[model samples]
Target: MKIVITGAGGQLGKELLQLFKEEGYMVFPYTKQQLDITNRAKIKEMIEKIQPDYLINTAAFTQVDLCESDIDKAYLINGIGPYYLACEAKEKKVKFFHISTDYVFDGEKIEPYMEDDSPNPKTIYGKSKQLGEALVLDAYESSTIIRTSWLYGHEGKNFVNTIKKLARHSLEMRVVHDQYGCPTYTKDLGIALKDLLTKPHGIYHVTNSGSCSWFEFATEIVTFLKSQTVVIPVSTEEYGLKTPRPMYSVLSQKKLNSNGVSLRNWKEGLHEYLKKEDDENGH
Candidate 1:
């Protein structure tokens, strides 16, 4: 089967590419320079040329604060981009897999969000992703929209790498303790995505099994690295960001569980990710 992955240079996309290559599948990985998803003509042309059985879209304007400031760019990349991809995929009779986020919820609910829960996005980024989800589902009945949270990987600028970088240079690092979500390892998620391709198509939530605050995640990183940096916990107010984050963005894997696919616990996934990084760097 021929599979096309957008955002090929991204962490998740790179992981997916590796997994697909290992499986001996014919994969076409396209970076932003190769194919602009926001350009409908380019998207249509790529879909026509690739003739893929699956088009997994990982492209997006992901900076939450930047999205808040540049609403047009956010919508263009996250919303209209996916819409065009879905449209092209529909026309080509290919299965569409669009990655979404847990930020679609307003964080008012304390429990892990189910797939059927109503989305009340509180930021421009969340709203744009929500819009993208709607477009994907509406445009293609065969599409699978996977909503994940707190994604980090070895290849990209994510929370884990940021913490690791800071730990190497800083004596003390203050992390927000109040904001809570699952820390999804991109490689694990990449494996999950490959598994999901064999399952029935629909909306699924794929994240590490458990949830934790940023502070807890940071503490684990410091502890694992045996770094001298002290990870101090602080509230979101103390950390003060331009974008309002979801206080609780834990996503339930009930849907994936029903499909007979499950992810390991967050801590276990984290350990594997860190170990992989260490191994790669000859630590």
Candidate 2:
């Protein structure tokens, strides 16, 4: 099978690229520098030339706060990019898989969000992603959209890296305890994506099982590292982020489970990630 992965520089994209290659698939990884999805002419040119079986789009303007300031750039990349890919993929009859976020929905529901849940985004990033999801599906109903949350991986700057960086500088740190979501590991999500290829194409909520607040997640990271960094829990008001966020964006994996695919719990994924870091560092 031939696969084309955009946003190859990202955490999830890098993981998918490595996993696909290890499984012996003919995979072409393209970073933003190589293939800007917003460029429609370039997208068509590349897709026609490669004739890939699958095009996985992981490229996105994920900086939540920055999205508020850069609305046009965010919509251009996050909203319109997938539309271009879907149009080209549909014409070429290639399977298009788009990655999305839990932020698509407002934190109105206390229970976990299902795939069919109504999306009322609270931020520019969420709105743009929601737009992207719609554009992809409208262009090609056969396209697959996977909504994930709180992702961390070895290859990129994520919450894990941020906390570790802060830990190195300060003995104490404050994390918001009110916000809640599933923390997904890119390696595990990549495996889930591979499994998804066997199932029907549509929207699916895929993430590590279970959920926790940022404060709890930070504590777990520190505990795993055996670091003396003190984590202080604070409310969202105290954190005072300029951009509004979904307070409870935990997505249910019932769709994935019904498809006979489910990821491990968040804690197990985190443990493996830390272990991988240790191995890489020769610890």
* Predicted model with the maximum lDDT: 2
Provide the TM-score for each candidate, comma-separated: 0.98, 0.99
Name the regions of candidate 1 deviating beyond 4 angstroms. Answer: none
> Could you tell me the lDDT of residue 138 within candidate 2?
98
Candidate 2, residue 226: Cα displacement in angstroms equals 0.9
In candidate 1, what are the lDDT values of residues 75-161, reduced to their tens digit? Answer: 999999999999999998998999999999999889999999999999999999999999888888789999999999877999999
Instruction: Point out where model 2 deviates above 4 Å.
Output: none
Measured with C-alpha atoms, the lDDT of residue 11 in candidate 2 is 89
Error of 1 at 11 (Å): 1.1
Q: What is the lDDT of every predicted structure here?
A: 0.93, 0.94
lDDT of 2 by residue, 1-283 (tens): 9999999999898999999999999999999999999999999999989999999999999999999999999999999999999999999999999999999999878999999999999999999999999999999999999999999988688999898787767899999999999999999999999999879999999999999999999999898888898999999999998988899999998889999999999999999998989899899
